[model samples]
Target: MKRYWKYIRPYLGAFILAPILMLTEVFGEILLPRLTSMIINNGVLERNEAYIVKMGIIMVLIAVIMAIGGIGAAYYSAKASISFSTDLRKDVFHKVQEFSFKNIDDFSTGSLVTRLTNDIQQIQNVVMLTLRMMFRAPGMLIGGLIMAYLMNRQLVSILLVVIPVLVILIAIILVVAFPRFEVMQKKIDRLNSGVQEALTNVRVIKSFVRETHEEEKFKTTNRDLKEGSLNAMKVVITAMPLMMLMMNITTIAVVWYGGNLIIAGRMPVGDLTAFTIYIVQILMSLMMLSMVFLQASRAMASLKRVKEVLDTEIDLTDEQASEKSAQIAAGKVEFKNVCFQYTKGTEDLVLDHINFTANPGETIGIIGATGSGKTSLVQLIPRLYDADEGEVLVDGINVKDYSIRNLREGVGMVLQKNVLFSGTIEENLRWGNETAGMDEIILMSESAQAHGFITSFKDGYDTDLGQGGSNVSGGQKQRLCIARTLLKKPKILILDDSTSAVDTATEARIRQSFTTTLKNTTKFIIAQRIGSVEYADKIIVLDEGKIAGIGTHQELMETCEAYQEIYYSQKDREKEAGA
Candidate 1:
């Protein structure tokens, strides 16, 4: 919570001004009762009509002042709270973006979304309430007690007893409810996760006809959240009623004792009336204070949740040493005895001591059985995850020596999972190079075999794509993703089974375009289809985490048993189709 104050610092003027206005408003409220008592005892009791009119006008003037103070406080508090929340949300978003893949994996996507949206909202509400009520409530509670005592100390004795009991009740509620609020937030995170998963995989659920099963899963999570919320509410509800009973009992004692005092000529009737109003104000103030603590407890829980993400140190940071390495020519990659494991104490290595190199203008193909570490090997070149041992070099320098932006810019990759945003075809293409002209977009789209379909649309380049490119076919989405990568015209292009969705004719055309249009760019192709890599300058076959063979397709077919098996399997499938 203290860490979040950096965002509030910019709006300090508003934060300070609001409390000042609120204090003035509380002063006005405290003064009004005293004025009422004077009017009753001096003017009304004497039946002086002139005095009554004068007091009435004074009361109206005070009321107007109070209204102005309230408005000023509200305006300042609202401005500060909203500005603080906006800055906080933006900071959290940027921090999340800077997080490494490992850091991102530590928190689920849905949980991050919850922290960004729901958790921030909870904190903002608490800040707003605190600004508006925190100072006012305390002033009212203390001021009301002092006024009541001064009016008639004999009746004020009830408060000394009542206040302690109310404090104890609030303390007990906080002790029990604070822990539950934290648990309730966790339950909300789980519920959000369930909803996000259902929405992301809605198509799979429909295809499997598992709507009923999904609904049951969602209901179970929803019920957990409901139970947690209700339990917290029940505790809060129990405390409020008990608090009201205590306040009412105190009020009754004050009235009964004061009436006897007035009858016995020990106290004035006007004083007794003022004392009752003071007692009511004190109780209301205490109630407001109790509610503030309750809300603050919940906000504390949300604050901790948001801080977790913000405090996460980015595992990958640009190194000063990387600056000298950027001067080297791009597309010179080297893997020297590289090894990797996702977690500590894991015996399995995703990539073993593998040595390889691909120079400028050269194409390298990686062929492997499922789980053979092909993707993991390439991921190291960009420093997505540092190798546990050995070095990954780009442009003849250790990748860690290059700035993250420079390293990524030099190497453009089309991931195995093709992703497209909700935008026009041209807008998606611009993601690769924001300043790319229309001619560049057309040339790149055509090279990736996506231009034809894009032009086929009524709006051509301006056609809006649905979220995740749901409006297009899988093949079209893959081509659009490829074109997006091509627009960058990166020095080293990595295609991780990017052409798997396209037909053989389209795939061949893309390959031809790469040889022609992308003559200067070094390409790393990871493909399961043997035909996809047959034309590569060199093909490396991976078995488990080690390199089984490294050569052209014809060389691997004859020299490597694993490669021979893959070749024969592909040939056999083609023969069956021919027959």
Candidate 2:
């Protein structure tokens, strides 16, 4: 919560001005009843119509002043609150972007989304409400009580009893309800996670005919959320009725005591009337305070949740050491005894003492069974994840020494799952090179074998794509992603099973075209298919995170049993399909 003040600090003038205006409005409201007392006791009792009319005009003037002040206060409060939330949201988004893969994995995507949207919205509403009501409520309550006592101290005795009872009740309610609100937020995160998962895998649910099962799962989570919300509401509902009951009792006592006093000639009728109004004002003000506190309690919970994300220190930072004057020649990579594991204090390493190097213009193919760490190995070259034990060098300098922007710009990587943003085809291509011209786009698209289909669209380069490229086929999305990478013309290109969705003929055409156009770029291709790796300059076979074989196709066929088994198994599948 303190960290969030950086955003609020700029709005300090508005924050102060809003409450001051609100206090003036509250002062006007408090003074109105006293003016009424004077009108009733002096004018009506003395039979002075002129005095009554004059006081009446003064009352109307006070109301007008309050109205104007209220509006001004509301305007400033709204402006400050909105600006505060906008700045806070921007800061949160930027912090999330800076988080490393390890930090992201600790908080799942659905939970992070909930924090960014729902949690922040909760805090924003509370800030706006607090600025509007904080000064007005307290001042009205205290000022009304002081005025009521000064008007007639005899009737004020009831308030001494009433205020304490209400305070105790509110205190108990807050204590019980505060913890429940935190739990309710966690439940919402779980519900959001469940819904996000079901939506993302709707295709899988339909293909497996498991719609009923998915529906049941969603129902269970929805019920859990409902129950949590209902329980919290129940606490609030129970406490509110008790508060009302206390206020009602105080009202009855005021009327009872004041009536007795009036009958005995101990109090003036107008004075007693004003006293009752002041007591009601005090009670109402306390109720408003309780309401504000309730919201503040929930906002406190939300504030803590939002602060957790902002407080997370970035795990990776660029080295402050002076730059060494060594130059890394283009397309050269070396991993010296590199090892990694996702978690610390774990005996199992994902990649073990791995040593490998690829020279300029060479095509290195990585083939492995599932979970053999092929993707993880390539991720190190771009410094996506630092190695646990040894150095990963691109050119000649350790990757850790390079700035993140410099490191990523030199490497073009297409992940196994291709993703496209919502934009025109040309806008998406510009992500690779912002200044790429139409001719450059066409050349790269054709080289990646994507131009023919792209030009088939009604708008070609101007064709608008849906989010995640949902409007395009899987193979087409892969091709566009490949073309986008090709436009970068990076020194090292990494394709992580990027062509898996394309037909064999199209894959062969793309590969052949790439080989000719990307002659100066080193390519690292990871594939499950034997055919994909067969054309590589050299192939490395990984078995259980260890390199079992490293050689060309002909060399591995005679010497590596693991390579032979994989090759023959893929051959048998091809033969069966052909037959």
Candidate 3:
């Protein structure tokens, strides 16, 4: 919470002015009851109409002043709080953007989203309440006590008993409620995860006719959240009733004792009247202070969650890079005894002692079974995750020597899971090269065998795509993704099973275009089908985490056991289908 003050310091003027204005209201409140007492004693009892009228006018003026001060205080406190939240949210978002894939994996997507939205909102509300109540509540409590004691110290004796009990109750509530709120927040995170997962896989759920199962899962999560929230609120709600009971008892005691003093002529009726108002003020202030403490406790949990993201050190920053390159003039890649694992110190390595090389303008093919580290291997080139041991080199220089932006810009990759945004075709294409001209875009589309279908659309390149390219066929989405990458004109291009949805004829044409248009670019094609990579200059076969074979398709078929097994199995499946 103290660390977050940098965001608040800029709004210090508003913070300062809000409490100062609230002081005016607090003083007016204290003065108003005394003025009423004066009217009851000197003006009404003595039948002094002139004194009554004068004091009444003064009371009206003070009321107006209190009204203005309260309004100003509310305005400034809101300004300070809202602005503080806005800056804090922006900072949290920027910090998330800097997170490496490993860093992101440390927290679930739902947890991060909750911290950004719900948790930040909780903190904002607490800040606003604190600004309004922090000074006003304490001042009112202290000032009310001073005024009550001055009027007649005898009436103040009741507070001695009530204050200690109220303090103890508040302390107990904080002790019990703090941990409950923390647990409740974790429950909210789980609830959010349930909702996010259900929405993201709604299509799968519907296709499988599992709507009832999904509903049950959601109900279970919702019930847990409900129960946790109730448990936390029970602690809070219990305090309110107990505080009010104590307050009523104190009021009754004050009146009973003050009445005896008034009748004995030891205390004036007016003094007794003023004493009651001060007592009410004192009790109400304590109640407000207790409520403030409860809110602060809840906000403490959210602050800790938010601080976790802000304090996370980005693992993939370019600060360690000692050199920068303007462009990847040549696409030559090599891996030397590389080993990597998703989790550090894990026994299972995703890629084990991997060694491979691709020369400028060469076409390389990667073939492997599922979970064979194909994607993990390509990701290392872009520095998405650094190798746990050994080295990855591009253009004869160690990859870690180059800045991440420069490294990634030079390598264009079309991932296995192609994604398209909700926008016009041109907009999605421009993500690869924002300054690309219309001719360049069309040429890349044609090379990727996407131009014909795109031109057939009524709006041509202006056609809008649905979210995740839901409106287009899988083949079309893959081609569009390929064209998008081609527009970058990168020195190295990687397609990770990107053409799987396309027919072999279309795939062949796309490959032919790659040979002609991307003659100078080194290319890597990772495919499950032998036909897709049979024409490549060299194909590498991966078994488990190690390279099983590396050669031309003919050489691999002759010399590699793993390659022979995959080729014959695929050939047998095709023959069975053909028959």
Candidate 4:
């Protein structure tokens, strides 16, 4: 709660003013009943027309004042609450943006989305109610009780018994309902997860003819959510009626006892009437108090969830970078006895004591079977995940020594899974180099072998792609991704199986363009096809977590057993296909 004060501080004036104005409305309500009692005794019963009209005018003035105060309270409360929630949501989103890969792994996407949207909304509602009702309810209750005692001290004794009973009931409701609200939030998270997954994988679900299975899975989560909500609400549903029953019973006792007092000449009819109104005021205020407490209990749970995101320590930072660190002007990279594990403190090593070097302007090919840590190895180049044990160097300086922004800017990586957001082709390309112009975009597209197909579209560069480039073929999407990376014109380019979707002929053309045009850029290509890396300056054969061999393609084919086995398998498959 203290952490969130910054958002509310800017609206402090509105926050303070709302409750103060609401108090005026409470005062008016308390005074109105007393004015009614005076009009009944001194004006109506005495048959004084002048007195009745004067008291009636006073009642009208009080009502007008209460209306104005209520409107002011509402306006200020709404302004403060809405602005606070907007700022809080923005901060939560910014914190999410700062999260490292490891940080994101700690919270699911669905859970984060729920916290941002629904949880913040819950807190907003509670804050608005706090400003408007938290003070007014208590003020009205106390004022009405005092006025009732002044009217007839004996008649108010009935409330002493009923108020204690209502307090006990509210306490019991809190004890039973708090834990259920927490569980209900978790159920909401599960429902959101199921919906998100089903939507994202709709194509796969349809192709597998699993609509019935998906429907059943959704039904299970939806039913759980419904049950949880019902259980949480059951406490409120039961408590409200019990409270009303107690209120009605207390009103009956007040009427029966007060009527006898009036008939016996011990009490005035006006005092009895005012005492009844005060009883209603006190009981209604207690009900409002219980409702506010219930809302606040749920909001406490939401506050904790939002605080979790804000407080998580980012795992990766660039605090150690200095001004004097060497720039990666020429693409040169090396790994020295590097060992890494995705899970910290785990004995399992994904890359074990691997050592390799690539000089400026050299093209290197890395080959291995699946799960040989191919993607993990290249990720270290840009410091996406730091190597657990050894140094990763760029431009002959430790990668850690350079600022993260500077280091990543010098290295362009086309990840294994290519993604394009919804936008014109030109807009997506600008993400790589914001300042890129028409000629530069056309040049990079041509180099990537994507220009020929792009021009076929009626809109050309202005063509809009669907989410994740769903409208394009796998090959076209891959080429467009490569073209986007080319716009960066980094010193080092890492293509991790980015060409696997394209045919061998188109792949050959792309590599040829890279060789001729990007002569000074160091390139690292990870591929399963031997033919893809046959013309490389060097080839690395990895077996398990170790580097089995590194040499020119012909040299590796002759001297490395792992390389020889892979080559023969590909040759045999090619011969069978040809036959």
- State which candidate has the highest lDDT: 3
Q: What is the lDDT of residue 407 in candidate 4?
A: 87
Sort the candidates on lDDT, descending order: 3, 4, 1, 2
lDDT string, candidate 1, 1-579, tens digits = 477679888999999988888887899879888888888898889898888899899889988988888999999999988888889999999999998888988998878888888888888888888998978989999999889988888888889888888889888888888889889988888999999889877988999999999999999999999999998788888978987898888889999999999999998888888898889889988888888888888888888899899889898888556474473355888889989988856989888899988889888999999999999888888778889999888777888888888888888899999999988888899999999989988999999999999999999999999778878998999999999999988888999999999999999999999988789888999999999999899898998999999998888878999999999999999999999
- Displacement of the residue 319 alpha carbon in candidate 1, Å: 3.9
Candidates 1 and 3: which is better by TM-score? Answer: 1
The 10-residue segment with the lowest total lDDT in model 2? 320-329
Q: What is the lDDT of residue 569 in candidate 3?
A: 98
| Residue pairs with clashing backbones, model 1 | 322-401
Which is the winner by TM-score between candidate 2 and candidate 4?
Answer: 2
lDDT of 3 at 209: 99
TM-score of each: 0.97, 0.96, 0.96, 0.95
Give residue 199's lDDT in candidate 3 (0 to 100). Answer: 85
lDDT of 3 by residue, 377-467 (tens): 8889888899999999999888888888899999999999899999999999999899999999999999999999999999999999977
Instruction: Kindly report which residue stretches of model 4 are placed more than 4 angstroms away from their true locations once superposed.
Output: 323-327
Report lDDT (Cα) of residue 376, candidate 3.
90
* Lowest summed lDDT window (length 10), candidate 1: 319-328
Count of clashes, each model: 1, 0, 0, 0
Better of 1 and 4 by lDDT: 4
